[model samples]
Target: MGPAISLLPALAIAFSASQSSAQTPAPYSPAKSGFDFPIYTNHPPGNTLPNDPVRRGATTPPLHPDETRKLIQVPPGFEVRVFASEPMVVNPVAMTWDERGRLWVLELYEYPRGAKPGEKPRDRIKILEDTDADGVADKVTVFADGFNLATGLALGNGGVYLGAAPNLYFLQDTNAPAGSGAGALQKANKQTVLLTGFGLEDRHELLNGFAWGPDGWLYMTHGVFTRSKVRDAHDPDGFGVQMDAALARFHPRTKKFEVFADGTSNPWGVDWNERGDAFVSACVIQHLFHMAPGGQYNRQGGTWANPFGYVGDLPTKGLPAVVDWRHYRAAHAGICIYQGDQFPPEWRGLVMLGNIHQNALNCDRLTPLGSTYRAEKESTLLGPAGEALRAKTGATIKQGEEWRHVGPGNFLVSGDPWFRPVSVQTGPDGALWVMDWCDRYPC
Candidate 1:
């Protein structure tokens, strides 16, 4: 693990700005007429709004798993199949793989509004397995239940780390017999509140994006608007680290917590390159950032945490966004550095991100820069490219003709407007596994 660090610098930097300068931007108000929704008007120049009328009206009823699969479009030699669907898996917001190749899915049944007082928490963690070497998940086990608004999940250190607002929990199965793989999770008998005091003002902005760093520390991200004073559970009244809209890490064995980096709005996904450099996908502002320990990035709104900390008008002034341009709505989540062998050789090492607002999965080419890296937009992996063509040419492209007009690099696209790929990962089988929220409204 890395050296013990304090958030004193981050706190000072975050709050040093004047009160007037630190005020957050006005919230988005709903539309009064038509299908126009409020957009993030605070974005810097060069950022344009998406087609709101079409996007807002694009909502279609949820398609059956088979029909939805038919609407999906992938590059030649690739196919999209149903892994798990409703009644089997619902509201899968996050996913991770264990050492034994079991997929752990975090289902947020109690979203928008968390469970009411005295009510049983509905969020759950389930383990899914394709026991017969089939593409679809045939086995599902509820590893844990009774969680309220849990958004992040990771399995390691003989237990699972869960990110539910106001607390980070660690659960272990005391009923497991000697030397069992995931049998330990088959019965979540013991629960430990590792750390406490996360914010829950915005249900969507809870503590999330749990990841393990190369140095063996468990890393997580916190969103803006929600201020957190995180302290060890055993010593809640003792010294705590103040965090807001930042990246933080914890050492499980040592029970040590540190703010790794600060300044990004609602960062829901984070991953590392082969060189151990960290990248994050955020929402509303710039969608991508190269995160480093002790670094402070430009905010979506409000003044810099530290006024004297490098001030510049350009968005790329400080620890810059990996990509300069913005995509549709810039609401990005779930990122992966492609290192799997399933994709073509040209696809290796690229950055994959889910554009929830655009209803697509996008790719970025990572090129080395001095000490950092630059992300250039690549082809749309899974999106409505065919629809774009139809709009331009006034010629309807049939379902099978979607990939014909697009480049080979555009891997997958779905005609279904509800194809919200919220999270993407390289599965154990070397294929890309996508967690489609399968909903019209991402938030």
Candidate 2:
């Protein structure tokens, strides 16, 4: 009588969320006079947070039905399902592929709702196309149309680098449709805001995540905007999330944005690990994907959590993001790392994530997802759309397998909270792709 903690399946728990509170609650919350303000860092610049960037703000893959991310365990080999759920094709937070394997995704139409913080978005920044890998997406165009809260997407140095929140753009494929084009996305167009005044949600700052670090440089993270309610100055909530949340490294040759690692509160997902070194994830759709390997980090060092009377020291903090704090809260979006081998290679470098709170998607190994950041591995069950909901629920566990487990990181664990596949990419074709901003709906 002591083995059944196995819950989740109450319809993937809260699934679609009733619809309309502007799509089921939480968005619109900006203007605390723009959340309060007090940022700007890099430390020695006279140590700052006195606010700057205006203060702010703000994925793909697809699959739904038959559950997702339930405390994962990946060891059996791999089969995971769903792969498609386009909730009308909009909120696709961040994804990239090009070079011909296709898969684009940036579509994040007006996503931050209620509870008041700095709300100001109407929509624009769509772009999707699956071209048959089946994770869903046959078309959902409009690559850039008045964006203000786009949040992460990269190809690197050569082009296609976006993150738009306070605006960061570059698209010249001019009208990329008819199969997502190539030759550098057939020369895209529009979208040109390289770096404007980021709104910084409330000192959670803004932008969230962005990556391109194979040494070519680009790494980023910004979130802590409640104007200046002061949430993360170094775990401002610690495992509770938000620690002054800010880490940067985008010297596209001195285009400058330095500020290498700060307190960071809303440090959402950013990646780099084939050795070029660099990994971050604190989007908090639930939390535990907080790795920090820009090389054992050190803005001067700081990590003594409980001394009460250190009088003045605090820089012993080198690689501390193992926050695996229990059952994620929607963990809003991602947690990618795995280097790839199509699975079962000892699961390779290991780390594949997307637990939009549940519906499932995780597969750890990055030293045990940073050492028991929960999901030591597995939570597959995502794909073939379960033969379109098993013809309508006759559910005999239909079809065969290839990567299936479906839910268990305590049900779509995100580290702590948030929902929907916020973003996931460990691609080069070794396989590990998720971005389901709505995969087309019904997850």
Candidate 3:
């Protein structure tokens, strides 16, 4: 095990192998093989890397968790901690809370580079429990494994829901071995394939953003790269419906699946408010949206056709986004509406979002505007009556400028690249838990 692997507890053995264990070796190039022939090196058009560092030299190594914690800067009253990292978990993309308050995480170990032909699936689903109430995960369990780029996770239906790109599986832990270590890795007692063909045109664009909607349906998101033909088992025709770039939901008991909102590039996060209104943080264009049933939003480079293929006014009827940041400088990872009470009353109801590229945490509030809703561009913490609350982070309306993400103020910014914040979840204790993807690559 390397330095990164040392962070894992002995029981967390799935990722104990070296990072290079299953990686493919780079191909041998004749140019670098002492063949000094006349090289035609001219500038290429469009997207091309000017300085390709292929075999030039090695880059910096992974940062130590302690070192990373130093570079993080949270809002004054808030503190950030490396709940878990490295060998214990790597590439922790998205996570969900189980009925028992256990955190189930989706580990896409094979990301940036999807599984190659003939390669075995190494991705896994891990359940982290802080039994000691130390605000840190003390027990790590391998709930499941053997997946290829598994990106989404949810807990319900008497088991765990896994997003394996084209297929969705419900696995119950009834048959799980009682102990940890190698004995814990057993097939689920009951396995149900709820749906299939969710599409994997691109690895990252697979079926994701799994959330149990306030309306009781299982909601998920798929990017434009995924051209899906999804169908439930109960469908008599045995033919799945075509779906792409939309917010969709499924009913386990009814055996029904439907698309609610359309025209999203790649929505990574989805959360529901007290009134059951849904909010999402998407990738690429349309960074923030207020989704409604049958609503349509436009995606650049899309056919401009309705995601549901509706006729009449549906094609031209697209809903505007709550917040269109105008720049693609940061890759937004996850967004969560603060439903926790541990934080100040003012922090409740504000939307907390994470920007992986920018290494920042964004906060904002949404207000109803006629038929649609609009976001408060300047992030703030409001009191019970929705008045600005003053705190060390300058929450006062006059000095609240420090909490703002837009305008002359800055959001919760971090100085280190390893501070990538991919998943943000409010814990049962009402504290915010962020998942970090600390590798050098964005994916």
Q: How accurate is candidate 2 locally (lDDT)?
A: 0.43
Model 1, global lDDT: 0.68
Under the 3 Å rule for N, CA and C atoms, how many clashes does model 3 have?
1
> After superposition, which runs of candidate 1 have C-alpha atoms over 4 Å from their true positions?
1-51, 54-58, 178-184, 303-308, 311-317, 379-411
**In model 1, what lDDT does residue 186 have?**
80
For model 2, what is the alpha-carbon lDDT of residue 53? 18
Q: How many steric clashes between backbone atoms does each model show? A: 2, 160, 1
lDDT of candidate 2 over 93-126, digit per residue (tens): 5666667655555654444431234655434444
Q: After aligning candidate 3 to the native by TM-score, how far in Å is the CA of 54 from where it should be?
A: 19
Model 1 lDDT tens row, 1-443: 11110000000000000111123423322111112223233458887646564345345555555555556544444545456655666777778888777778888777767777898888899887768764456788999999988888988877889998899999899777656655356868899999998888877778888989899999888788788889998995778888878889999889999888878788877889888999988987878889988888866654444557677662545566766677656767788787777666676787777766665666777888888888776654434555545554577766654333333224445566666676767766566667776555556
lDDT-best of 1 and 2: 1
Order of quality (lDDT): 1, 3, 2
Ten-residue stretch with the least lDDT total in model 2: 1-10
RMSD of model 2 against the true structure: 20.8
- Residue 142 accuracy (lDDT) in model 3: 80
Worst 10 residues of 1 by lDDT: 5-14
lDDT of 3 by residue, 359-402 (tens): 56666677888877788644443222113123334553544323
Off by over 4 Å in 3: 1-47, 50-60, 176-187, 233-237, 304-317, 324-330, 379-411
Which regions of candidate 2 deviate over 4 angstroms? 1-93, 96-104, 107-124, 130-140, 152-206, 210-243, 246-311, 317-335, 339-344, 349-365, 368-443
Instruction: At residue 404, give the lDDT of candidate 2.
Output: 33
